[model samples]
Target: MKSRRPKIVVIGGGTGLPVILSNLRDQDVDITAVVTVADDGGSSGIIRHYVNVVPPGDIRNVMVALAEIPGIYKDLFQYRFETTDDFFAGHAIGNLIIAALSEMKGGIFDAVQELSQLMRVNGHIYPAANEPLELHAQFADGTTLRGEAEITAAHKLIKRVWVETSNHHAQPRAAQPVIDAIMDADQIVLGPGSLFTSILPNLMISSVGKAVRESPAEVVYICNIMTQKGETENFTDADHVRVLNEHLGANFIDTVLVNTGKVPDKYIDYQRWDEMSQPVKHDFQGLRSQGCRVISTDFLQLRDNGAFHNGQEVVHELLNLIGQPRFQKDSRG
Candidate 1:
């Protein structure tokens, strides 16, 4: 008889989440990705304006990452129309499908579930919220930016960030499944994405934040290899965990994955990897101060002139975290 697969719930958005999920699929684990809905740029932003649904770009990418199909069909789902088609230009076929399903199902949560089946996704994919969410950032100088694109484009030092409805009044919400996934998971992972915009937006949701704080699951944060332009200009690995703890109002992260690999002085091309400034500085002592067990490894890969965590190596570390005292959750579903 087969045993149950260890369940892992990854909470974040952006390109990073998919890399980790794609790698984790090789392991005997159940995966659930909680993607950020704070996107308001490019195809996602334009679609959100038209349909009033959570931007599908991040969710779509995650779906493709976890999809268990041939490369040709995956390419079809990701295909974008040429600029010659004025209206559909730059929109991914997968993005359009997600929007249509959202409208048909009356919410992004249901749309993703139905789409996940068709995609033959190995695990669940859920948007962080039910409705559209806007990202708001307060920079070091105390000025504020309204949207994800605007904040990243500003190239300013971000002091803090949070997410709420576009109107800025009522609190944002996470679907019941999102919270349940977190609370019942054997381990919860965060990161390898934007600190403020990508990871924090999902945590900033009221119930999601509270559940993360209260969940018995071991929370492992995979720190980024390079610093983002505006989000994490000169941050250390420990600084990343500090910001997440501050935003969530608790030191909940149990383990942090730090890349010990060094990038050559001029290794990164400024134009190709424009958003990143430099390698993320590491402060092992600082991480110790925060009660986090730092797992440093040569988990770095330079791709397309950008520094990224070695996805396969990162997933190995995550699997190791399971069954350990620190990562062991006391409760069962």
Candidate 2:
């Protein structure tokens, strides 16, 4: 008889979640993606504004990543409108489908599940909340920004972020599954995404934070290769963990994976001159002092199109971490 595969819950939203999920799909692990619902841009924004639905872009990305469908279906789902019109341009077909399903099912979570089934997704994808959420950011300069778009475009240092409504609640339907997944999970992985916006937002959910703090699963954090321009302008690995622990409380993460290789000079020059983004400095000692172990490796693999991370290399590192003897030990220590 074969041993059962480990259950894993990946928490984040947007491009990063899908990349991680896509790499893990063929592995012997059961995956659950808990996506942040604070997105208010493009097609997602349109649907949220018009119908009061949680933006489905991240969930749609995960769905496509985990989908076992053929090439044609994948291409069709990923197709976006290329017109110059303000009404329909830049809208994703999958986003519209998910929005329509949410309208039919009366909520975004149900719509996601319905779409997952239709797409033949190998695992589950859930929104962090049922109600539409506005992402509000308090900048270091005492300036406040509302909505995801404005926050991303602020170009200022963000002090903190929170949901708009005090009465905002995690979709109990979404929380229950997350809790269940955590209880059954052997490991939980956080990011390779934006530290403040993508990764931290999910952990900010009251129920989700409680579940993570109390879960018995070992938590792994994949630190970003480069600092994001507006979000993590000058953030180091230690800074990332510090903010995460501050938001989710102390002793939240177990292991942090850092990229150890030197970035190509050409890319570094391009980033400095073109993108104006800096490299994320890894401070292993700083992270270790905060009760988390550091795992360093050459995890960066940039493509011709400027995309980073060779999927197989990341999967190899993740699998190595999972197979470690330390991984079986108590994460609380």
Candidate 3:
């Protein structure tokens, strides 16, 4: 009998998730992306304010990443209007498409699944929640901020983060399909995105967090290459893992992918990419203390004077891990 494809669930938002998904699409595996809906920035924020739907910018990009359609179709979907356009200015065509579909379908979850079939997406794209979620962060200075944009712009060290409904009455929850995806996953991956804003917002969802903690899959974290000025300035790799563990109230991460590459400082254009501070410092001992197996290597790709993971390299490692004896034993048992 033919074996079932390995089911991999990637959880996070921002640019990193799509980059990794686009590469994983080429491999023979079942991919499910659990995207964060806590965005309140740029086009997404604008749409959220007016349309009152889960931000579609991240979901739209994830669609393109896993889409098995023509390049022209993808291009048309991703096309963004110029700021000069008054009515629909600064919004991607895909975002508007998702918004329209959400309204037609009466919810974001159903709309994404419908669009996923239309786009011929290789796998599933599940929003971390059905409704729009507000990200609330408490800074180390004892001040609290609401909205993902406000929290990141505060540039203060974050103490912790949680999500709430727009009215702050109901607790946010994931769709049953999302929880089932986590429960059935052969491997689960988190972040190559913002530590607090991009990654945590999804996990902070009570159901999603509980499912992740209790899931049997080997949890992997693709540690960021550079520390962000607002989110993780002067942060070590271990610090990132610690924050994740503390928020979930469990030391659950099983493996961490760290970049041991040297980034040339002068190559970074501070003027353009001001959000990034520097390379994430490594602490092998701290990672071990958290009960994580560290995979350190040269996973860097330098382009546009910015540091990023070479997605092919990262996916190669992921496939290798899935084939290992330990993973086979854990997954089969």
lDDT for model 3: 0.93
Residue 242 miss distance in model 2 (angstroms): 0.7
Worst 10 residues of 3 by lDDT: 324-333
Of the two candidates 2 and 3, the one with more favorable lDDT, higher being better, is 3
Q: After superposition, which runs of candidate 2 have C-alpha atoms over 4 Å from their true positions?
A: 84-87, 165-174, 268-276, 305-307, 327-333
For model 2, give the 10-residue run with minimal summed lDDT: 165-174
Tens digits of per-residue lDDT for model 1, 1-333: 987888999999988999999999878999999999999988999899998889999998999999998999899999988989998999999889999999999999999999889889998888899899988889889899889999999999887888889777889989899999999988989988999889998998989988987888888999999999977888998899989888877778888999999998887998987888888998999887877888999999888766888889999899988878873333211
lDDT of 2 by residue, 154-186 (tens): 789988887654244543334478777766777
| Cα error, candidate 1, residue 57 (Å) | 0.5
- Rank all candidate structures by their TM-score, best first, as comma-separated numbers: 3, 1, 2
- Winner on lDDT between 1 and 2 is 1
TM-score of 3: 0.97
Tell me the spans in candidate 1 whose CA falls farther than 4 Å from its real position. 1-3, 327-333
Given candidate 3, what's the lDDT at residue 1? 100
lDDT, residue 37, model 2: 87
Clashes of each: 0, 0, 0
RMSD of each: 2.6, 2.7, 2.3
Give the Cα lDDT of each candidate.
0.89, 0.79, 0.93
